[model samples]
Target: MLLLQQSSWALYEPVPESYYVHQKNINSVTFEENTTTYLSGQWQYYPKQLLQTATPTRPSRTVLLPISFKEMGYPQNTYGTFIGHFKIPKEFIGRRIAIWIPNQYGAYRMYLNGDFLLRLGKVGKTIQTQQTENAPRFAYFIAESEYFTVTMQVSSFQSLHGGLENPMRIGVSQTVNRQFQQLMMSIAGVCGAVIGVGVFTILFAIFRGVRHSQSQGFFVFGIFIIFLALHNLFSAPYVYTVFTNIDWLWGTRLEYIFTYLSAFFFINYMFLLNQRYLHPAVFTIAVFVLSFNIVITFLSVPEVFEKLVFYSFLLGIIVVLNFAYGFYQTVNRHEPYSTINLWAVVLLCVTFLHDFLLSLNWIDSVNLSFASTSFYAFLIMVQQSKNYAYHSSRIEKLNNNLLCTRQIS
Candidate 1:
């Protein structure tokens, strides 16, 4: 019986030893008696072209297995091949053997005892796992008592962008299954909710128009919802197709512009809901600043657009503070809808904080879509409060008119 274990150098400090035991022949042997031995250590690597002719020589350079090529200090321009030699015991004649590579980049070819066994390649730009099988006899025929050699030829194209530090890992495992079904499901659910909310908001806006003609805040809020919904939908695969044909640089610029515009609209709406109209000067200044954001978004370079977006974020915080103060003043005084508007303002502020943290990568678990949903819920509550205020005002006016008419009669 042999026991085998393998692990990465970064993760584990001490390598464990494996023990093999032999017992006298018995009538029957249980499956539990069998043990696995792991072939784990540094391997000699050479350029792919040199593998065919050059004699195998151990270089002083040593790299841990299941590692990335880039981290090994290989030339940035080329992919290298790795060769490892190990001995198998003569007693392990009829047992099945398997090799596992925890991670690999781009593509890889596997060979056993200098004989080609499998080739794996990704079908698209996305990371996908593919497998090729070899006959069991190939494994049996290749097993040797002295030393069995295994070689891997791995490549990472220079043109491939993103995640350059991703590593290649190899191990031997009896089972292999790597799929992220649950994560995909969660992403899908969030995307569906975002799209659904967007659709509903658009339909509500079309049918209801502005709830109050004099309240520019109501119109702004509706427009903000529309833009936000569209942004969320665009983040998913379904609508990505329409934008895929567009130039990448322009598409990115447009995305930032839309995000800033949505934030601006929301801020303006919150101010109106709190009945705290900004002074004409402040309002005009905000408009000018937002216009500048728009103009800069069209710049060919992204750095300028990023700076404008950051400025817009700061402006949004200022607007929120202004609205909060207005709600504080009005909630205690005259406005009938003030309390509800105040609550909505508070919720909106919280949503903003959550979203900001998410954007900064400070919070990992909470999705931005949840904050958007809460925003829409708050909008509905504020709209209902407005309706209640309208009806209360109308009843009061009628009551006063009746009392005066009775006195005159």
Candidate 2:
């Protein structure tokens, strides 16, 4: 039996005896009152077809909540029905009770007291609320006694990109936590890719005797690119193996580094496009701004630093736009290295805008995974641009030598 009591600010669920208690007090903050119940155990589950003709007289298998049926050796099929009976406690009378379902890959239909409560279809979290009156979906009756039998039936559909045997379970608290974790992981992966490619590119350039030259813009870009990747990794939960002592410091520093290096890379890229047209004054001002932001990030308090980062992101976007415009202008002028460079700049702008909008919660459907892939494509374009520029310069020199020989003859 599940008992729920609703308060003005919070909900309360009486702790069940069968609930598994993992950790009670580790860096814990005591709430005014605890308002959650662990509803996990052997739930009566079967294939969807088995439920239409007849309900099983005896349970074929008992599954756990907050877990996928596939985790229990069930086939990777969806649309199974879950039926469970719970007892309502007398203490929960006259309170608003709600169910929290974590998000799965696709859709879910839920019933309580034999009445449909809600239908949800998405890849994120969802919460369902219902009144105790009016013949609940599974079964919730006003009991004259201390306890009443409550029932719930849930049906979920398979995901579109079906590879995983286990889908994420749906419920409120778990869904919120899982989404947050996923966002961090996505950021980490992006950072790792940026760093990995940058390192290889830098080493390759140096091996080719392109040390500290204007052509080394690629290497400079690589340094900051990798720094940003490391930044993301440090900010996530999966940072146990490397740089363990100053995790928080690295995370904070990388936030500043991302903006500074991105600006620096843009400036250097412009220099590569045209050394004469590169505005030294503008580069100087950008450097000053970057340094100022880094200092602010380190000195401000944690909450204040977070706000500053958001503002800095806006500034960074403007700077990126400036670079994009420069690239466009160079390409329009038919500059020596325009073709591949312009493509790289265009791709970078698209991916940056896509990711920025997603981070701000402006677009719900944008996948960071796909966005990162686009960024990698942009990197490849930039590499091709470097190769074209090198080969073209060499050919021009050879043509000049031939002309000199003809004049001497």
Candidate 3:
């Protein structure tokens, strides 16, 4: 029998804590020969819901899904089921196990060995009937048997993508729970830092910008950072556990709204900082993108609005790339504050791409993009402070020159 393998090098094998199973996009199931067997390969997919009494037949198509359903070529706004088989490592049998879904859109239910295990949100055939889950969740169950059959029924009426975007993992309940807590702490740190930075910049812009006026960028940028921070906080699965008042639906909606607003303001901030390097066309593109987001938010239902946000995020990449090119030119010209701007742009571009991938379920990691925003704001504030001092000195020199000229006359 052929067992699934990741690569030729055993040195690169999966760690003991977790095994990254190879998943196929097809809809079918393969039972194990023995209780010790590890099942991998194509999982049967049924794009329609299975009746409570029905069992799935052979899947119609086979594909790979290391990312979200939108990228997996699945039809938008659909419901489906995925069935696969896996075995518990003998050491983990009888131990408490936690199932980890890195990312998925819509609502879903999980079953183990044909028994109902856990469900997130509400899975229904229609949008009005369906409920959505925004935060990540950990489903802990006892490994009653060595061999397990798993099924996931998912629906996505509100999101652009559905199905399992990233791979799932099963590990000891304690270990997984610990990891979850660490992730929460890391995200909380990011949120707190962003709020602190936001308040400082906004105040500086109001008091200081009133005099210099060049600090307008700080005001817009501060608001943008706050939105981005909220997005991160709301998206983290742990937030729901702490803030029970916030439901998955509104939390997710606000996450989308904040993301769209942040992108809109980000372009404005960049343009304010370096009008020489930025072009009217780039600003126009940003405006068009923001307008599209507004129309979608108002015209479409919350579910659709949330799903469509990914497209806006894609457009944001283009905006950032444009800014990167402009910053490169500034660096070449050795303009005042250009060095700081150049580095900040580079850092932002990298973090933006990282978070974008995470959003699409293309990658999974603790998001550090919020931290980058703080760094960028700090650099811009420093540059503005320097410019203020230079202006004051220039005025002082001119007044001195006027006095000497009068004395000579």
Most TM-score-accurate candidate: 3
Best by lDDT: 3
CA-lDDT, candidates in order: 0.47, 0.46, 0.64
TM-scores for all candidates: the values are 0.46, 0.45, 0.71
lDDT of 1 at 336: 62
For each candidate in turn, give its C-alpha RMSD to the true structure in angstroms: 13.1, 18.1, 9.8
**Candidate 3 lDDT score at position 380:** 68
Model 3, runs deviating above 4 Å: 1-42, 49-74, 235-244, 280-292, 302-334, 350-409
Q: Backbone collision count in every prediction? A: 4, 21, 6
In candidate 1, which residue pairs get closer than 3 Å at backbone N, Cα or C atoms, i.e. clash? Answer: 66-168, 66-169, 100-171, 101-170
Candidate 2, 1-409: lDDT as tens digits: 0122111112223333343133121111111112344334344565443232115464445555545544555543344555444443445445333343333323444444344445433211221221111111111222232221122333323222111112222123333333434554565565566666778767766876676574376576566566545544533232321324343334445644564566566566566556543456656666677777777766763345545556666756666666666666666877666455556556656766776664443564433424453365456646656777999999999999999999999
Q: For residue 235, what is the lDDT in candidate 2?
A: 33
> What shift in Å separates residue 148 of candidate 3 from its native position after superposition?
1.8
